[model samples]
Target chain A: GAGVSQSPSNKVTEKGKDVELRCDPISGHTALYWYRQRLGQGLEFLIYFQGNSAPDKSGLPSDRFSAERTGESVSTLTIQRTQQEDSAVYLCASSLVFGPPRETQYFGPGTRLLVL
Target chain B: AQSVAQPEDQVNVAEGNPLTVKCTYSVSGNPYLFWYVQYPNRGLQFLLKYITGDNLVKGSYGFEAEFNKSQTSFHLKKPSALVSDSALYFCAVRGFTDKLIFGTGTRLQVFP
Candidate 1:
């Protein structure tokens, strides 16, 4: 794809329901990232995927949040037993490089999840 | 740890006037700075970045930012503001590692 693509642009789920968000990064990009943005708040880092290596899950808010990536391609973010506090816009980004002085990150349109 | 800070919640500027969005960062090593803009119902668009060259880095959409080492700041600026430039701006900082930390963001409102 020419740019990062995310699925289910908007989602409204009841509290305690599980939700899955998908992301497809640009071809040949080596790095991917997930972030959460609450209403009127900043983007919060969630996880990072670099190739087939173990993903950097340091930013996951809790055990209910998990993510996986297939090689260097599509990635999915799953939230189990979502809470009201979990309602936010989930964003995906990809970069051509992932090392020091990394280049610009191309962001997806983002999935707006509303936990009612 | 690496982090970026955008102190202002919002900035209002008149068309054709100069505009600035302040940003500051804290990192362990040399800093890699970036600026991104976002419009309503859209994704973030890359504006510019500062790596290892000149203090002033130019980017897309006639936007530019100055990197200040002593002040630990990288402020985005434009000589003239346009109403179309109204959008949300984010500042990010990455150290010598792969991690990129972002600031809260600043909402820029340009009036005609």
Candidate 2:
């Protein structure tokens, strides 16, 4: 089966610019999530989207980070005024559903963002 | 807050030898534990998870983990190591929230 997919395998942008990373979840998946993985660090939760529900933006580090998912398919994570600290791998994952005894999350290759 | 901890930054083991990577978690209620691996320059790959039922959960690529409720641990283990298994392993835990809290990660290096 097709897995989650992300675009722009690698991105290089100047500081103060805005960058958008895209994610396409697996077919039939009803939940999507975005996370940030800094070099040699753990993954930091960014946002989550469930079918027709308000996205969870609790993990966004600041107002600069935001994400949106249309229906239950694709999601885009936008970072405004990118900073050096924003340089990291942006990963997307999706599952069949979100609930108790949560389903396994299938991940995408990720978009490596570099801010210069 | 829910959190996970991988005590070792790195673990080295010879091929054909058993290997273990430690993980401990802290959460408010019953925890949903997970294991994921990342190859160099690749995204995370789900290995296995411990939601309930059996204490020992088997996962992809001949890997398994033991969920110890009393200890609040879910350590990944493999009977024999393969060089191909070398990668960054992450332990994660989810409580009542929709997000998973991940550990710092453990790098596994298997020598031949």
Q: In order, how many clashes per candidate?
A: 0, 0
Tens-digit per-residue lDDT, A32-113, candidate 1: 9999989888888899999878899999999999999999999999999999999999999999977754777899999999
With a 3 Å backbone cut-off (N, CA, C), the pairs that clash in candidate 2 are none
At residue A3, what lDDT does model 1 achieve?
A: 98
Kindly provide the TM-score of model 1 when superposed on the true structure, using C-alpha atoms.
0.97
Give the root-mean-square deviation of each candidate in angstroms: 1.0, 0.7
Question: In order, what DockQ does each candidate have?
Answer: 0.78, 0.89
Quote the chain B TM-score of every prediction.
Answer: 0.97, 0.99
Query: In terms of DockQ, which candidate is strongest?
Result: 2
Which residue runs of candidate 1 sit more than 4 Å off their true CA positions?
none
Q: Residues B19-112, candidate 1, lDDT per residue (tens digit)?
A: 9999999998888899999899888899999989899999999999999999999999999999999999999987765656889999999999
